[model samples]
Target: MDMREFAGSSFITVESLRAGPREEVVVSVAPGKYDKPVATFKSGDQLTLNKTNVRTLIKAYGEDSRDWVGCSIELSIGPTKYDGDQIESVVVKPISPPKPLAARTPVPKPPPPKNDMNDDAAAF
Candidate 1:
């Protein structure tokens, strides 16, 4: 269950992921189309392709998060097709995760020592 932050604009390809037969690909989204994928499966409902057919799939997902926006793209094997070495490698750039929110409360500073009480210690 690997999670990534998708800003709603990233190119992806099956070759880059090295997908194999009977493998499943899972995509999870938030408010925006660009939310990072939430899960991936090897086969079954979560699976999109199988050993028999490979198709070229290119799609995007997008969503609006408050003031921020996001989306993503997915490319897979098409019918009667296999991405071999002949096909140029599609460069899929990695997405960076969002930063943590800022703390609401302020940190307190330590109190300073009293000068009068330290006067005797300094005299010694």
Candidate 2:
């Protein structure tokens, strides 16, 4: 895509989780690859760009596990001054599977001893 357009500020499309809080996220401009600094964000964090910047959809998440819900994304670019500033905040709810319910079947109880085979309760 066009990294220049994404230079100012924009949201990232998290694809999968990587090492630490980092995750593989996609950028609107760089549709071919991902970006760098793979760090997570909050509802009001600033995403920055550095020398090791690349166009990749993968990023190292930090604390956006409750926001980026593995779905659509809406990049919000800040002013040109804070283009490469630290991500102020983000609102991404990580999409995760729901907790399991109860078990299907219960364990069966042992059968009682036969009257004739009973050692203690057997009648004469």
Candidate 3:
């Protein structure tokens, strides 16, 4: 089975989030919102956030998801230690607000010839 459909890339957006019953946090991963949808992740695909990723999210978007309604989270699958066994787990990368692009001046275009005739050729 493709793990990407679960959580394996930087194409997840915080659709809605809430603290789970215990230490877990339920996060709805919605692709195609902030980034392109890969594999098959619907609008409300469930993704239980790992503790490490959750803490990272809190660091980036703050604890309350109300402050992160439309924030982007870059996640990827990587090696992680779990229960003394090495395993591939969903990883969270640093997330920061996008910076503004530098303003560019519009290039001037040469005006079209007054007449539609070829400049080098005379009308016959």
Candidate 4:
């Protein structure tokens, strides 16, 4: 049995897409996502780039597919018209700036050591 059969959906989706618009590194470009040339991501999800998506990538990364490898792109679901019907589709967008690290909570300082002298005086 092909182990990849259980690897989940080969195509990326809004629900399956990683949280937020994280940059996805291109693993390879091949024909498979939908019988057409698709970009495979490091996560093993393949995305068939529509014309708009292709243009977006081209504008951001240029035309060379070889150059596309190792490059980052953000995938998100956007409204698109298909056969006169508006449907949600995977779209590629330029990677956004990395979010700033969350603020860390400062560790509380330990309480001052008890003064032995004070205890001795109290006992007197």
Indicate which candidate wins on lDDT. Answer: 4
Give the runs in model 2 whose Cα sits over 4 Å from its true position. Answer: 1-69, 80-124
| TM-score for predicted model 4 compared with the true structure | 0.60
Q: For candidate 3, lDDT tens digit of each residue in 1-124?
A: 8565576434233323222111222344334333422222233344545666666655665544444344555555666777999876656554445222332223347898798677797679
Relative to the true structure, how large is the alpha-carbon lDDT of every model? 0.30, 0.32, 0.46, 0.69
Q: What is the TM-score of each candidate against the true structure?
A: 0.17, 0.17, 0.41, 0.60
Off by over 4 Å in 1: 1-12, 17-19, 25-27, 31-76, 79-124
- 5-95: candidate 4 lDDT, tens digit per residue: 5786477776765465556888787665455578888777787778788777666665655556777787877888789999877778777
- Those runs of model 3 whose alpha carbons end farther than 4 Å from true positions after fitting are 1-42, 94-124
Candidate 1 displacement at residue 58 in angstroms: 17
Report the number of clashing residue pairs per model: 26, 46, 0, 0
Worst 10 residues of 2 by lDDT: 54-63
CA error at residue 113 for candidate 4, angstroms? 90
2 or 3, which is superior by TM-score? 3
Scored by lDDT, model 3 comes in at 0.46
Top-down TM-score ranking: 4, 3, 1, 2
Instruction: Give Cα distance to truth, residue 23, candidate 1, Å.
Output: 1.8
